[model samples]
Target: MSREEAVQRVAALIKGIKFCMLVTQTDQGRLHSRPVTTQEQDFDGDLWFIGGKDTEWVHDISQRPEINLAYAQPDGQNYVSITGRARLVEDRAKLEEVWSDFYKAYFPEGIDDPNVQLIHVDTHGAELWESSGKLASAFALAKGLVTGERGDMGSNETVSLE
Candidate 1:
């Protein structure tokens, strides 16, 4: 598929996914991943997440801006992996823009909470895998068995956002 088409598909898949695993490297050189909610908005080749400034992941990002986000929609058999650079954003306007009631459970003080912070991920590139579903999966398996070769199981593509 064309790069433009792949970008569109990646945005679509991400829109359907509510949560993603945000991976960051610790100062100790170990990888750490945590589940983060994606802010509700158009993808636009960037991702925003809300977190506390005191969180370890935030600290990790401060030390190492390079990160990865993994999104999976098991129901649709769609998966996306994004590599990017992240930075802490303390903009109040942006905070109000992405704030939602769901975050209250984590930050009881609301958007004004002193510890509340925004994590902005500037996406560089992404890899996506979209499965064709059960019927197609069965067909692929059968075809593989008959031909003794790997059949087309799904669509996989790499998209450049930068």
Candidate 2:
């Protein structure tokens, strides 16, 4: 697929997914992953996430900027894996723009809370797997089983975001 089309497909697949697993490398070189709320915004090769300044993930990003984000929509059988470089940003304007009252649970002091921080991910590339639907997938699998061939599960592609 074309680069732009690939990006749009990814955006559509992850549209309503509220959270994704953010994976980072610890100081000891171990990979750690945690679920984080995805900021409500359009996907355009960059993603924004709100986090706490004192969080361990923040520290990991500071030490190792390379990170991975995994987004999944099991009901639709769509999954996206993104690799990128992340940095801690303190952009007040952006913080205010993406801020939501829901975050008060974590930053009780509001947007101005010192602990509130932004994680900016500049995506380098992504791998996406999307299925036609459950019924189609089942049929394909059944056909494959009978014919002794691999099932056409779905479209899988690796696209460069940069």
Per-residue lDDT over 1-162 for candidate 2, one digit per residue giving the tens place of the 0 to 100 score: 676886787789889899999999999999999999998898987899999989999999999999999999999899999999999998889988889999999998998898998989999889999998999999999999999998889999898888
For model 2, which pairs clash?
none
lDDT of each: 0.89, 0.92
Off by over 4 Å in 1: 1-4, 145-147
- Residue 38, candidate 2: Cα error in Å is 0.7
Residue lDDT tens for model 1, 63-93: 9999999999987788999999999997889
Question: Highest lDDT among the candidates is held by which one?
Answer: 2
Q: Give lDDT for model 1.
A: 0.89
> Model 1 reaches what TM-score against the true structure?
0.93
